[model samples]
Target: MNIGIIPMRYAKALFAFAQDKGMEETVYAEMNQLARSFAEHASLKTILDNPVLKSKEKQALICTAAGTQVSDIFVRFIEMVLHHKREKHLQSIALMYQDLYRKARQITIGSLVTATPLSADEENRMRKMLMMDKEGTLEFKATVDPEILGGFIFGIDTYRLDASVATQLKRVKNQFMDKNRKSL
Candidate 1:
């Protein structure tokens, strides 16, 4: 996510590779599950980070552990990383692939941070607003951020719209100071 260049490169390559191998869906599913697993088990990632263990061995261990739950393409992809000595970037690869897969479906991911939990009607209204503005279809995930105080902050891709009470308060304070300075 942070290293945009690297993730993009890896994601593009992986997307193409998966497509050519006729395992795009399998890869996408496996990558998503891998990302979830990485989030839930930090220690598992550390094990993958072991420099002493050869990449092939590490991948084999993961493939064996994951077993039938993961696809053959997923296992082969892991092995390819070990073969290339890029095992350390496995997590990043998974994240990048997930992003690529989502984007391919014209599904943009957005987040809404609200002062409080939004009611179903309110959430639907927001979704409608987004749909009206969106160039393509999108899926949004709302998060409750009490620090916003009252309003909401919407984020999509790299753009964020902060229409929050916290920001409104700051604007009001700045306006007051400006007016006072003008009078002085």
Candidate 2:
């Protein structure tokens, strides 16, 4: 997850290559699923990282774990990574590829966490407020977290709006503490 330029560079190249080859859509889905598989199957990395296993064996294991859902090109992509000894960073590369795909397609993935679920009208209003424009699609996932107390936390990529009551209360508490410190 903490990968840097290597994965990003690989993902950009892959994304561009897929686009040129007219396989962007197929490869994008495969990359996302590949990243998710790494997350869902913890042992996948352990198995892949086993130096005792040959590169071909590792590639076969990855392809098997990936199943027929992935395209032949994607399988070859995995093989290429194994061949280059970059298997360990495959998860990061997959994640970066998804990010690149979303960016290219103008898809913004965001999360809305609230103390409670939003009503139909409220949800629509929130969408309007957050989306700002009609060109890009907002892929929003909603979650209820009572710990927020009230309001909502809207997050998209690196940006986050924390209007939750819990956060507000913490700010007030910090202000009060600052005031008390000055008096003392």
Candidate 3:
């Protein structure tokens, strides 16, 4: 049983179930929070990852710590993971579940790598362009990359539009070589 397969399958199923129950938003938020918590607390994650811990005891401790912050359905999901000794896959499950949420909501997530921090106006303009160009709602996450030199690169899903100065310089260099060859 590959961890990735199990988590992704379960995540899709959970997303479907939550959507049907009209709890998709809430469930998505919960999974996101859980993922963030797991990231912030490495020791807690280590405990969950430990295979020697008895499933029942682990479930009890986790359920207690989770308190009322997570929904009952999510708690049961956690219990099931513990029962199967698959707690280590929780973060993956959460991430997959978020992907499901985004798909269902008609929201597109993208990344923008820029040479410098975008001004508020630039950020808004980019977001507007994405929204107008895309078929659905756009959610852009911007990352600063000093190496880009001057321009920006936008990526939506697997589609990338490279407008960076680095790419521009490469294209210019290629054109120069082409021109030089014609004169030879």
Candidate 4:
């Protein structure tokens, strides 16, 4: 069986279960933290994925690491994963769960990268414009990257809006090369 399939199926099922219980937000955050913990603590993965460890032992280790804020349902979910020997794919399951939760709630997430930080007013205006057409809540984040030279780049899911000076220069350079080649 494909490893990806396991997580996708499990995550979809878990998302549905969480929705039925009206715990989507709580479960999403717990799953996100679980994924982050796995990423940050390599030793946890080593322990959980070790074939020598019993399922109960692995569950204990994971429960200890998952923090007390996680719901009992989430802890049981983890136990199920361990019992089924799918610990290695827990991170992927968490990510897929987050995606499903956001999509179901009609949420849109976007990021903006600019040469410098935006003023409070500018940030507020940009956020309003982005959310204006959105049918649901928007999660917008801003970052500064001087390497963009000037201007900004915004992205949401698969779509990107690039207006950076670097990208403009590249477009001009490509056009110049095309003209030079035609002349030759």
Candidate 5:
């Protein structure tokens, strides 16, 4: 009864069920919303795990957290999870479902971090360039972080290209420190 196994088992079953119902995409979106909700609200788990709160109330909270409207399939799946007292694992289940959906749909998640925001055309060009050597559709996001100082950092799936000035400067500083140590 490993903790990790519970979420994976529930997520796999939910994924298969959603696929059979042709509602996997809808459920995937709901799961992503749910995961984000959990991340943003640390007290959510504490509230959910309260034995004083009724099951129906918990269901309402879950649905509200997901979005204004969720698919019936998602509602039913949440009902089942609550029935089995697996509400505590809801966050993990949502994340695992997203992972399963991404893998099954061959969607590669990527992000670009730059010192400044790129224009629409520049962003599209960078996304296209990154996708050229990769497989499947890319779910790309562009974010601005002035802390990077300059250049950009691009990541796709498990690979990352750290061309940011901050990282480069750190590398040079480390090299100088090592050289000084060696001479001393």
Candidate 6:
């Protein structure tokens, strides 16, 4: 069986089920939390994959990792996943559900990384400028990363614009090295 197919199938079912129950938004939030838990805790996968852990225990762990409280639809989905011994793909399922939700709702996810934090006005201006050419609602998140040295990196969906000083310096360094090699 294809590994990717399993998560997609499960996620599609969960998305449809949540929509039918009018809990899609709640489930989406829970899935995002669950996905973040998986990313932040590498041991989570190892614990879920442990053979000694009972289904109930794993279920409890997953529910706790999701958030303070999850929707009934999410709980039922987790039960179904545990019942089918698909706990190993829980992370992927959560991420897939998020993707499905975002696509269905026509939400565009974007991120801005800069050496320094932008003021609220600046952030709003940036968001407005970026949204000018894009369709649908934009969910913009700004993060600070001093490693970039200066300037900013903007990304919307799969497209990324890297104008950071560090990256430019690296490109210049690479070009110098190549020239030196050619001259040698």
**lDDT agreement with native, every candidate:** 0.79, 0.84, 0.81, 0.86, 0.95, 0.94
Clashing pairs in 3: none
Error (Å) of candidate 5 at residue 112 is: 0.3
Best by lDDT: 5
lDDT of 6 by residue, 68-178 (tens): 998788888889999999999999999999999999998999899999999999999988898898678888999999999999999999999999999999999999999
Instruction: For residues 1-184, write the lDDT of model 1, one tens digit per residue.
Output: 5556665677688789888988888888777777777787788778888888776679766664444477776777677777776666777888889888877767777789988998999888877887776677777898898987998898887789999999999999999999999999
TM-score of each: 0.71, 0.79, 0.70, 0.79, 0.90, 0.96
Cα deviation at 70, candidate 5, in Å, is 1.0
Q: Which regions of candidate 6 are displaced past 4 Å?
A: none
Instruction: Choose 2 or 3, whichever is better by lDDT.
Output: 2
Residue-wise C-alpha lDDT for candidate 3, range 43-134, written one tens digit per residue: 77788777788887777656544444667777778877777777878778888998888887888988899988989898898888878766
Model 5, 20-114: lDDT tens digits are 99999999999999999999999999999999999999999999999999999999999999999999999999999999999999899999999
Superposition error at 69 for model 6 (Å): 0.7
The per-residue C-alpha lDDT of model 5 at residue 21 equals 93
Clashing pairs for model 2 are none
Return the clash pairs for model 6, or none.
Answer: none
Comparing candidate 4 with candidate 5, which one achieves the higher lDDT? Answer: 5
Q: Candidate 4: list runs displaced more than 4 Å.
A: 38-47, 53-68, 166-184
Q: Per-residue CA lDDT of candidate 2, range 12-94, in tens?
A: 88888888889999998778667778989999999889999999888877766665667777877787788788888888888
